[model samples]
Target: MSRIVERVRRVRFTWTHLAALVIALLVAAPLYWMAVSSFKGKDEIGANPPTVFADHPTWDNYREAFADNNFGTYLLNSVLVSVIATILVLSLSSFAGYALARLPLRGKAPIMVALLMISLFPTIALAAPLFLLMRDVGWLNSYQGLIIVYTALNVPFAVWILRNFFLGIPKEMEEVAWVDGASPVRTVLTVILPQARPGMFTAAIFTFTACWTEFLIALTLNTADRYRTMPVGLALFGSQFTVPYGTIFAAATVSVLPIALLVLVFRRAVVSGLTAGAVKG
Candidate 1:
């Protein structure tokens, strides 16, 4: 019986590993194809057979991508908007979350539910109203406009996540801060926030990712080339009659670099934050 159980366990482990490998390949295949396509020339990219491997890999695609479009400008815009949006969302959400978690407030549950419901509505639904509002406020084609929209879009999730995470933290810490004559603001900044790093990290990462990849809002808000983010700028690679596959692939590969770097740098923090939040709350 013992031998049989051990054999079954080994078999299960083998199957699990195989399943994981297959899933990883599926997830990675599109990215792998994009990277490979970026290295290929236009002719090779548009080959009849759709070659998996480039026959003659060249740097022309990347060169043409930069030469054809304002790639640098787009990249800078995306970085700025994403960073600012992330900061604002995190700051505002943290304050809201702390209040909801610690303060004596009426209708907190209903407020949270309402926020969640609002977030559930599709972005497309809000696009028209938002565009009108931004235009009226003379915020069109502005970094601040995009940042404000992104922050508003992401805050609900941040509040929900951070609020629960805050609740998991011991209230005794805040009590100690109060006993030390710390005001609510001072207690939040010094005592509570330090302990809530994981939640904040998680919220920041989510907000940044959302803002970085957001295309529709950016496109609608910013008609000017200077204000366009990577997603919108990428759309300009293809012409009216024909698509530039090589340039598109190359541009996409470049656009992914910042997000890839972010993941590499913050993987540990993200994992820890997610795990802590999940377990604690």
Candidate 2:
């Protein structure tokens, strides 16, 4: 019986691994094609039956993309906006989450519902109002305008994730800190935060990704050439006459690197955080 059980477990594990590999390949194939096509010559990119690999790989695409698009400036703008927006989102979400999860706050359930509603509200509906507001405040085509908008859009979701993660932690952790004379703020900082590191990392990843890849709001607000993000910059690579797929893909490949590196670096924390929250409220 023991030998039979071992064999069954082994087979199940093998199947699981096989399924995971297949899924990974499916998701990665498009990204792989984009990366490879970035290295191909402009004419080769438009081949009738697209080449799986570059015929003669060259760096011309990268060079031309940067030279034509002020790509470095756009890259810097994207990084600045994303980093600042992410920091604000994470900071605001953490405190709000702790309050909702652990504190004696009134109407917590209703507040959470309200947050979900706000997140679900259509961005397009608010665009005109937001544009006018920014214009009145003289913030159009500015970094601060984009950062604040991104933070507002991202914080609600982050709070929901972190709140659930916090609920999963034992109350005794905070109680112990309180018993030792630590205040609420101190307890949260020294006790809760260290234990909640994974949750924070998870929230950070989502916030950063949302800010990094956000296109619509960025395009709508930052119309000035100097203020535009990479997505906006990449969009202008095509004209009525021609679409330079090779250059666009080259820029896209570079743009994807930062987000990819973030996920790889935080893979363990993100996995634990996501799974931990799944079983909680």
Error of 1 at 205 (Å): 1.3
lDDT of 2 by residue, 1-281 (tens): 99999999999999999999999999999999999999999788989998999999999889988987688888999999999999999889988999999889999999999999988888888788889989999999999999999999999999998999999889998889999999998988898889999999999999888888888888889999999999889888878998888888999999999989989999999999999888898
TM accuracy, model 2: 0.94
Q: Across residues 43-129, which tens digit of lDDT does each residue of candidate 1 receive?
A: 887789899898899988888778777887898899999998898898899899989888999999899899899778799988899
lDDT of each: 0.88, 0.92
The worst-scoring run of ten residues by lDDT in candidate 2 lies at 64-73
Q: Give me the candidate number with maximum TM-score.
A: 2
- The local lDDT score (0 to 100) that residue 126 gets in candidate 1 is 84
